[model samples]
Target: MANTKSAEKRNRQAQKRRARNTTVRTTVKTALKKARETIATKDAAKTPDALKDAIRTLNKAASKGVIHPRNASRRIARLTKAAQASKAATK
Candidate 1:
């Protein structure tokens, strides 16, 4: 428990930020998972759209500081590489 007034307020702020971060994190995970699934299925039409959606979510998370910019970049790069490889394999 917080011992001071400021501490109590800080705790409350932390809780709110935690909840917001969790929601953003969950959204990123869902987008990434869907993108991976789309890639695995090799649905040419769906793959690009899914990849774009995933990238967009990652960027948003990074911009919001929920995830590091470099982390988001790494994830985006890896996913894009996998998507490209999948496309090549199909061709």
Candidate 2:
């Protein structure tokens, strides 16, 4: 319960931010899942595009402050490494 007006306003703002962050997080998760699935399925042609999308989403989230920059960077790095390893194995 926000007793003060300022506190009430802050609560409202927090709710809005929470909703926005949840949506962005969901998008990031979905993108990452798709990229991993493509890689695991050995769809070499689709893997790069999927990974690119995931990285893009992660960057967007980080830029918007929904995720930490380093967290996004780590995820991007891991996905890129996995894609490269898969490609090498296929060759």
Candidate 3:
């Protein structure tokens, strides 16, 4: 439906960007989910490292503008707290 040349070019660019952004966001979310699940399972021995990895992933996504920095920070903070609490509960 993009009739003009410029419109067609813009559509192509938008599609490409959407695909890339989706991949990045999905990767970031998957990392976060794994970290959360690991913490939820109360595997204290592994959670600290998992949390570190999740935080790193979130920061990377934020830096790349895949997600907002504030949103990433908040997610990281919540994940950290949950991981810590899980560890504490198990001890």
RMSD of each: 0.4, 0.5, 1.1
| Model 1, span 2-45: residue lDDT tens | 99999999999999999999999999999999999999999999
Q: TM-score for every candidate vs. truth?
A: 0.99, 0.98, 0.91
lDDT of each: 0.99, 0.96, 0.90
Clashes of each: 0, 0, 0
After superposition, which runs of candidate 3 have C-alpha atoms over 4 Å from their true positions? none
In TM-score terms, candidate 3 sits at: 0.91
| lDDT of predicted model 1 | 0.99
Model 3, residue 14: displacement in angstroms? Answer: 0.6
Task: Give the Cα-based TM-score of candidate 2 against the true structure.
Answer: 0.98
Candidate 3 has its poorest 10 consecutive residues by lDDT at: 44-53
Say what the RMSD of model 3 is: 1.1
Looking at model 3, residue 4 earns an lDDT score of 100
Q: If both were scored by lDDT, which would come out higher, candidate 1 or candidate 2?
A: 1
Deviation from native of the Cα of residue 7 in model 3, angstroms: 1.4
